[model samples]
Target: MRTSYFICGIYVLMDLASSDERSFRIYFDEFSIKYKVPDIFEKMDSTLVQLNNRSYINAEMILKRDVADLNVRAIMEFWKPKAQTNMKLYDVRVDGCNLLQSINKNKLFNFYVKSFKKHANVILKCPLKANFSYKMVDWFLDENDLPLFVPLGTFRTITEYFTQKRLAIRVLVHGKVLPKS
Candidate 1:
């Protein structure tokens, strides 16, 4: 058996060799999006759905204006059981176009690209045109992604999308890990 972990839109497999075989599995229960520039997006929709006994995140977004420069910043937070405060685990920003062009350079981003390659239809480079619709259907992370060790608990990842130097959209994904029996 294998377990997969997703953090900040990146999927990683928990394959640490240990004497104990028990491990936890992560699953998403909710997803939401916030538009800083409400009018800049022609359409934005994200929802968690169940299909054929499997969970998938369906999302679609259409831009109302063209974009020449693109950047992304992701912040991940982890919380203990019944904990009132959460701790920030990672926070980094990168050029979206460059990252997409050289997806293999960054191990984490490469996992994201691998997942997106199967489930998402969006721009891979710059010069995004207006009224172009992009979507991710039946998206779920599995063992074929990256490798990361995430303990049993809850986590939240907030990803912000930017056009030029201005903030455009924000994505909030919440999930938790439960012991597999």
Candidate 2:
């Protein structure tokens, strides 16, 4: 069938693949996060990390946004890295608990320092908590220094590239939600 698509102008594209099992790809697109779930509808094979021989998956990723007061709660994803190629995401929750919890700013600062010490090559910035709320953690980073989030295409696209994996990170900055205009 022909599907209407628009990038700059309207165009028609052929749509194949049966409607049974499908996959959803999530990628960070500049300001907001974008998710694409193929039209194929049956059941989705939710695999967090599809690696080679080793496979490990996280249950879920929760993101709480408080736009009114520049604050956001990011509940980290929980995953157990198995052998080397077998990875799967068991649970997927966006708002759960803060895994990396530091008692106070001093502790958080120390934790950040230690993390950088371990991952020397990586550029990880110090995390800052929003003045309004503690749950909302924001990273202080300049525009030039930011990490790029790329999502691998679909099964067809996967073959073109390699397995979907987060490329090298440029810099780690805590993100803060700003009041909507």
Best by lDDT: 1
Candidate 2 on 32-66: residue-level lDDT in tens?
22223222112212223324322222221122322
Candidates in order, TM-scores: namely: 0.76, 0.16
lDDT of 1 at 87: 90
Q: Model 2 off-target regions past 4 Å?
A: 1-68, 83-181
Q: Record all residue pairs in model 1 with backbone atoms less than 3 Å apart, i.e. clashing.
A: none
lDDT of 1: 0.75
Residue-level lDDT tens digits of model 1 in 1-181: 1333335223323233333354555577778888888767899888898555445888888888877788999998988888889999889999887887888889866766788889978646677767988889888765334244557779999999998578988888888765654
RMSD of each: 8.4, 21.6
TM-score of 1: 0.76
